[model samples]
Target: MSQDYSSRGSVSRIDASISVPVRTFIFSSLLWLLVASVLSLIVALKLQVPSFLGECPWFTYGRIETLQRNAFIYGWASNALFALNLWIMSSLARFELKSSWLPVLGGIVWNLTLTYGLIQVLLGQLNGFALLEMPKEVAPAMVVAFLFAALWPAVAFARRPTGNVFVSQWYIIGATFVFPVITVVAQLMLLWCPTLGVMQALVHSWFYQNLILLWLGGSALSAVYYFVAKESGRTISAYYLATVGFWTLFLFASWTGPATLLGGPIPVWLQSVGVVAALLMLVPTVITAVNIFGTLAPRNGIAQAWNNTTLRFVLVGAISFTLSALLNIVFSTRSLNALVRFTPFGQAQEHLAIYSFVSMVIFGAAYYILPRLTGSFWPSAKLVHLHFWSCAAGSLLFVVAGLTQGWAAHGRTDFAVSALPGLLAASLLLVGHFAFALNALGMLAADKAPSNRRSY
Candidate 1:
């Protein structure tokens, strides 16, 4: 939040202790982000020109698209969370991280496992379930590595020196504990011990929804809660709502997944339950909006929000999160579902939730955390600006195009014509991701440069 950002100091011994491991995870995440961006562009192009990579089976739209999503989720997003959340947890708990090598080693193994799974996916060895496309063989390794990376944070939370726990810590630790359980359930039911009929779909939907809303969404909210307070120099505006919001999000978001299976092979009762739960999502969403935006109101003016790089990204993300929640409720209704189901509307919703809301928050957190970890400011403010605008424009374009495509489908418009905007959006995202990667790498390099070095 300070203009002299280069002088930002580490908050605790834990931050200094975990610097190397956190940097390892972040660097790996950047590489995977580049990979995902390239794949995204390819997949977007192939949607328009099916024969774009005609001769190569591995580059087929299905494979490339799946790989892109997996790389973004497991490779990019998960790694970033591991780095950011672990640090956030330790700092909040005022506990030093022990066995830093554990996270470093875990990050290495996790990425390697992801690499193997992605290769297998390209080789047509996918498990065929959405978001759980990675082959069953990789599941054990992924879980083990996740545990290794997650251990210190759990220890820090449990052994905190102080009795006072922050809202961010509550959300972070909740997400950390929930993910492995949901993931293991998904793996066991979908892959290891296959379920019968639509139960498979039910399980996958449940897992996917929880992964997005609980794990990814929860983590992003944690960052929002911390940074909003940090940057605004105030406690959260609606501090009392924080507890209710936390519990409701976890309680209701889990049941909302079955709404995705509306009018599918699932039973009507279950689908109805999901609809009710999805509508109920408004409870937490409204609370979050009030808490974040209320705290986000600037004492100066609009210019202040725009000038603060982290606040800019976080504000966009907070707005997107609220929008996503509303859209999800709309889509959950049977009338709207019938209109847009099987079209690109669902994908558009996912894009808004993940890229616009979750990834934007992650980017904002990275901008703040990397400087502290590396003891150097971002080397290029222009690149930071570039990254923000490109991603913002791209996410908007993609979401608009996707929703337009869905509506067009209902209007009997040509699919080919409808997809053109998506191609353009993907191209912009590729550029944004490159800028982000370069900027991050530059910061990392600056950390080691003789002139930038300083004692922690």
Candidate 2:
């Protein structure tokens, strides 16, 4: 009897059987996050010690902030999702890559864009809007890189038998296919083929929201659904219900970003709709989170056994998925929104979404991916533990400090350290940065070689 795991529509096995390219993508993403994390800290430090790295034009706060965002979002988060989607497609279709070269090319282009984009940002020509900071030149490159990158999985899934679609597959495969399409269209319309006076502000808002919710956020959720459901060892009781969640989310959350940019000059209707849609988004996010966590409820049993690095990282991601969504909703509120619009609080929200929610999921995927690709477990479990703790602790501290200090700045609280000391907010951020740096070092040092194969 060929113990047919696929027959039952199970993808649990794929976690243990990823290829080298898939694994490399995972590692590279972590590396990006790890490095970007350091830049974030340095940027924070520059806040307090304005003259610490004085006149080193390249190391200015402005430059480092942009670099940190680029590395974390595009370099780290995007790469991780790209790699995991490849693995998911391969498993769903039961097919090996026809040519890994395409993926390699994709990765090259993606990294090149990140490198070039950072250089431009450091040189101070970045567009510099909250969440839309990547310059137009770099944005177009991202479109090309992402399109090329999305192809591998498109091929992988295309080859699969239609009957094999699992709930996880829908989100994973569908998201991979959807992202390139949405991003490509958004980039073209918003950047390349601009139509003058055609609700430019509205279009811009839609593009930003979709890039995040439709492309990045959707991709992030797709992986969470897969890993969480799989890790839970339960076949998400209601696949159809999930489709309901997806489409509803697509329709509602898709239009809310422009609204989030409320108080700006967009039409009243657009902003109003955004506020409503943002709240409505809670429906999907909450439903999905409840279902996933419910499936994984008695989390101790099977999860305890696979206390592997990959599982732990993903678990954090899964939990964060819900938390970040909740945070987005809070920030989405006009009452709270006004306070955090341009403050570090907005940065905190992005980091939580990208770092804790998205990156954590990718980290989990890497943990599961590396052992198979390299034909070895991570060199050290302890090292992985260190990486895990450092990242977790650092992110928690950063978000908490940023939000609190941001409010202090906004409120102009006389008692708030920031009111008395000009450096108070920045100083809090610097402390968080120091913690972030320690975590990054932990990530770099986490890799280990097999002990017995000293000469290999």
Candidate 3:
């Protein structure tokens, strides 16, 4: 057993050796996140006052919305996921990352492509689909860049020292493999070949759902499993159930696309299948919640768990995920769907899942991982607290106000007044983003002196 452990020195080397690439990814991600936040603020303000940015054609709602989504998903989320998953894969596989230069080059290319794509979007060259709005010219470059970026992690997983794989490894590997395939397929069908009229909508919907569930959600869950287990100092509870949850998510989640088109021209059977899939999502959600919540529950006492910042963020994210799942199930129902389908409810649900849940989990993982990667402690606990509260408060305000807007807009045509509060609430999130940016920059700039740091 000791020999088995000794053979894993490469994994330790990974932690010590990959600091430069990891910091590059993280720093780039935060910079993009700040950019996304500014775009989001603009969009929110535009919602309240349509004329706010109407003077410039590039700043029109449609173009800004597309740019905002691209920046958030590709710029912020994808970059952060690359850094986190690279570390997670190396840690789990007990191997050092090979060909590290590939990811660094890939990171540069990815950011450049995203910058070009957003510029094109602002210039009105959008593909006109929800998430696929990035110009098709950049798609091939993105695919190549992603392949390069993901190569090291893929190699590390393949060369894992042990047959035993952790739950986090499963999620990280699954997402890593799945994202590129779906992305290429979506690009071909929707952008390259151009699916027939209504089929285009279907294809776009399918891709969007798959991207959210299989990619973003998978990576976030990986972080959740890893951080929760590490911080709690416990192996996952009901381990087999986690496997079941993973498989269920992969199998059923993609079929949920048609539910988004309940009132559209899609076939009844397809919508029925989507609704069924949405409802079936409860299986994985419940299983995941049970396993994670059980492991996070008090062992000796609750104080340790309560005091842990990572655990607190993960727990809140888990709860948000579970609630989002329940709300998806509820809103997919025919009666409820009819009421909220055309309103801000869907946006509320999206913000809850992506911003509140996935982003929170990533933030927690950053809090834990950054210190180790940077060889320094976070500069200020106060900033961390400020970030947490601001995010929580802002999310609560946005969701509540969005729900209120949706309720008020249920049967009405003019709902601008109803959306005012949500717009105001969304502006508060800028404060949280600023707090995070300041904290991150301070940590990066602070001396890496051992004397100034607490032991991780």
Candidate 4:
């Protein structure tokens, strides 16, 4: 692994052939992430102040919280992956964005629809659940718009030079072509299907899980596989293991969400299947993580060569995967759920999975990929360091706060369906959530500045 990377470092840098749909998607995606991060910051503040925005209908916690999470999940992460995927596909295929305007249009439509959906959520015109907040009509509309935009990438991939297909490219290409199609179909059915009953919850979970895994996780993992291996100059020692893991993740994880609702009013079998899938995820998640970590294990040259933002964030992300897998199993257990299910402990568990592992890895990948996409180096190394440090420390603080207070509030019998107990939990959650939002904002601000700018 180290040897492969060292050689690449010594090789000359290559300028992008040109911007195309791929780069277009990536840059647009990051821009949406900025907007989403800002919204997240607002939501976090609302959690603390409750009336931070003077009781505007759209600015309330219910409204803002829904928007904040959606923005990050759909707006930020999906698009970030989209952007990175487009750029890599373009390079692999040796094609410019076939129609640059397509990605632009897709970006416009995506942001417009997402903004409208957020407004609907804020207006209290939509359901108020975690990833299911977007109304049916709007969700489908966004999907159609993205499909129209994604066509260019499909065409480019088809047209790209045929060569020894890198394992990463295979997944990336498959995800790029099929992802929007899946999202569109699922959402349209969700909107029109009266069959969506308690199964509505099932469908909802399926959509959310697939969106993250197929849409975001697929691309992000592919990029990490490509970059980590390529940058390290190591062809994955166990490429077959990596591929098998991918299939395992996709198959088993598709049925995994109902497990989160186990012991709730969903079908027993739904929960049963989901529970099995959730537990099984450990196999692939660990396998993939090991493959990446092993490749980067020899720090002899990586520290100096792949040393900057790209590798550092990747390492943090890689380590976080193990934590997420273990936590997923722990939280999914029925024995542990009695006290933690509705408590901040659940919140702690999810945050570390998304923010610590998934988001951070993508962040690291962006530190590397975005510079190539944007035709400029990161604005500030010191700022990047600040972003990494404050976020890592604050998240540690937040997760600890969530678990400790969750244990306190939930463990005690005094916690019942009253506003006071709710307030206690809410307040503790607020502190940790605020810390998270502040650090994310700092990172966003730093990304826009020059790499040599004044430290945060």
The TM-score leader among the candidates is: 1
Give candidate 1's root-mean-square deviation (CA, Å).
2.4
Best by lDDT: 1
* Candidate 4 lDDT by residue in tens digits, 352-384: 766676677777776665544333445555556
Query: What lDDT does each candidate get?
Result: 0.85, 0.64, 0.81, 0.63
Q: Once model 4 is optimally superposed onto the true structure by TM-score, how far is the C-alpha of residue 235 displaced, in angstroms?
A: 2.3
TM-score of each: 0.95, 0.82, 0.93, 0.81
| TM-score-sorted candidate list, best first | 1, 3, 2, 4
**Alpha-carbon error at 384 in model 3, in Å?**
0.6
Give per-residue CA lDDT, model 2, range 1-456, as digits (tens). Answer: 122343321223333333445645655675676677567656666655668677778777777777877687777778878887777666667765645666667777888877877777777766634444666777666667777676666676667756566555566655666565665665566667765664656766676667666667677677767766655556665556787788777787777867557778767777778888988889888778766665666646336624755667776776777887788887788887887787767767766777677766766766554444333334455556666776677667667667566867666543234322223333443343344334433433443322222121
Q: Write the residue-wise lDDT of candidate 3 on 1-456 in tens digits.
A: 121223321223556555556766788899998998889888888877889978889899989888888899988888988888888777777666555677889989989998998999989898778878888988889889988876566677789888977888888888888888888988999988987878887888888888888888998999999988887888888988999999999888889999988888977898999999999999999999888887877564235765888877777788889888889999999998998887888888988888888888888888877776656668889989988888888878778877878877775545677777677666777788788888887876663322333223
lDDT tens digits by residue: candidate 1, 198-273: 8999999899999999989998899889878886677788899999999999999999888998899889999999
lDDT of 3: 0.81
Evaluate candidate 2 by giving its C-alpha RMSD to the native, one decimal: 5.6
TM-score of candidate 2 relative to the true fold = 0.82
Ranking by lDDT: 1, 3, 2, 4
**Which parts of model 4 have CA positions greater than 4 angstroms off?**
1-31, 49-54, 151-153, 299-306, 411-456
Model 2: CA > 4 A from native = 1-20, 130-135, 193-201, 298-308, 411-456
lDDT of 4 at 341: 76
